[model samples]
Target: IQQKEHPKFKRKGDDLFVEHTLSITEALCGFQFILTHLDNRQLLVKSQPGEVVKPDSFKAINDEGMPMYQRPIMRGKLYIHFTVDFPDSLSLDQSKALEAVLPPKMTAQISEMELD
Candidate 1:
């Protein structure tokens, strides 16, 4: 049966895509949340400690999306497209705190620096 829309997610073929926004803190420190699926299932979506989810990146939950058309046993993947919501500016205290908690910035090789 065709429906007008699924409020929480959008479907592409058999896969489902969720557009989610995370605070800079959540992106860096990792987060956990529950998602209500189209079929009335609660899904746990999370990130491991120290796992940074970059902006515009995606993580997929296998077999958690839509079922294939005419294929009941098989299911598509749920893709969470993350957008990191960074502040326009950070206070000195916030900056210092982040520096202490986060890893050092990655240094580029001499060859790669030329591309910057």
Candidate 2:
């Protein structure tokens, strides 16, 4: 974490000015998705793993068995960062499966995994 000093402000006269400066440090954590457009395009579709996928890859099936091949823009390194609020019941095999899909260099940091 890095500490940054920012100026505090107060509005008094017509001219706005900083009354004082305060130092603060903020901590932020979240998942990051790095996707590459399969078609070599700049547009990227980002979402968490197991989240609602884009409309293209999956098709809504009706009782009549109507199949629609909605090609979603696929391609890119999807990085998912898990927080402390993440579930603790995940198994090692499941985690390994996810790591396999990632690029050779990309790896997930699993902080805790204990078998009973």
Worst 10 residues of 2 by lDDT: 19-28
Question: For candidate 1, lDDT tens digit of each residue in 77-112?
Answer: 999999999899989998898889778989966786
Alpha-carbon error at 30 in model 1, in Å?
1.0
Q: Estimate each model's TM-score.
A: 0.80, 0.18
How high is the CA lDDT of each candidate model?
Answer: 0.89, 0.30
Predicted model with the maximum TM-score = 1
Question: RMSD for each model, in Å, please?
Answer: 4.5, 22.2
The lDDT, on a scale of 0 to 1, for candidate 2 is: 0.30
| Candidate 1, backbone clash total | 0
